[model samples]
Target: MNGHSGNVFVLSAPSGTGKSTLAKRLVKDVPDLDFSISFTTRAPRAGETDGKDYFFVDDATFDRMIRTGGLVEWVEVYGHKYGTGKEWVSAHLAAGKDILLDIETQGARNVHGTLPDAVMIFLIPPSAEELSNRLRSRGRDPEAEIQVRLDYAKHELCEYPAYDYLVVNDTLDRAYRDLESIVLATRLRRERMGDTAQRILEGF
Candidate 1:
């Protein structure tokens, strides 16, 4: 439907589900894929860069961007606001660059509404116990906060039906392969191959 414009790949998963790790790997391993760095109102963790990890901003700046219609999609997660910039995503996509959006389920749904053709993938843990173990292993949050995240994970899992693909991250290698296949398959879809199809037809 977007013709030759780039495709948007939206990846969403519950906290501690390895979504971020997979996204980083996908961009590193795949060709011509760009990761969309979102803006966040939360303080940066140690070793996190301002623009590389996220565009860390104050509440006022984030509110201003919201008022000026600069955000493509935004959501409040764990008391902090995170949003994707409208201009940046539009410019890169129009240049025919595939972009990966690592966002929450709500933001993914919002992006889907805005860009109907965007590919949405939901990552699932092998089991609830595994998810809880993963959260505890992080050692980043307090016990209570970790419980909150696990509770939220249950609700998030319910939204998997809405996603285009469900990737079970039981094993990292297998999950990465699945994610990679989805990216490749989307690029070969009929609508995205219009220009290539024309060139081939012309040769005949």
Candidate 2:
């Protein structure tokens, strides 16, 4: 049951679903929560710092990690590669720090395979039309790329049933509150509070 460790919260959503924004805000506003910065081969976008937003690397470095198994899971998307570090996740979880992992749906499933107790949260927009509108409003991708993302979102939304929680991002503030409540509820679960509960019983 991974007693005395920390909870791994896997947050996943389609591109332009505002998952990144929600993750950043949750880590910023919440206490004792760490963001698992992913490694990517993609070039830095505007205002994206090297170590903060992502650890930008070349294809060779990314391949090395894959070959050496330094990454827990990796995937290629839109011609760029992304991966999560194995050591970082292990060390943080051992230290009892709840970490938020923002990855794709497939990666989340892979993580669940190993960490069966990990909390999986799938975020979605109100509707498919709204998802397309959000993707188009970003202005980051062209018409074809946007269409590709929309098509993927439709497919990804179907996988939400596999997740532990489904959050509809109708409004940012409301969604944030939902995330906070989930964290609190998970923390207070009897399995996670084994030590604390035992101590209280001993006192009685």
lDDT against the true structure, each candidate: 0.93, 0.89
Cα lDDT, model 2, residue 4 = 72
lDDT of 2 by residue, 36-134 (tens): 999999999999999999999999999999999899778887789988999999999999899899989878878876678889999999888888888
C-alpha RMSD by candidate, in order? 1.6, 1.8
Assess the local accuracy of residue 161 in candidate 1 as a C-alpha lDDT between 0 and 100.
86
lDDT of 1 by residue, 1-204 (tens): 235789999999999999988999999999989999999999999999999999999999999999999998999988899999999999998898999999899888888767788999999999999999999999999999999999999989999988999999999999999999999999999888888889889999
On TM-score, the leading prediction is 1
Off by over 4 Å in 2: 1-3
TM-score of 2: 0.95
Assess every candidate by TM-score: 0.96, 0.95
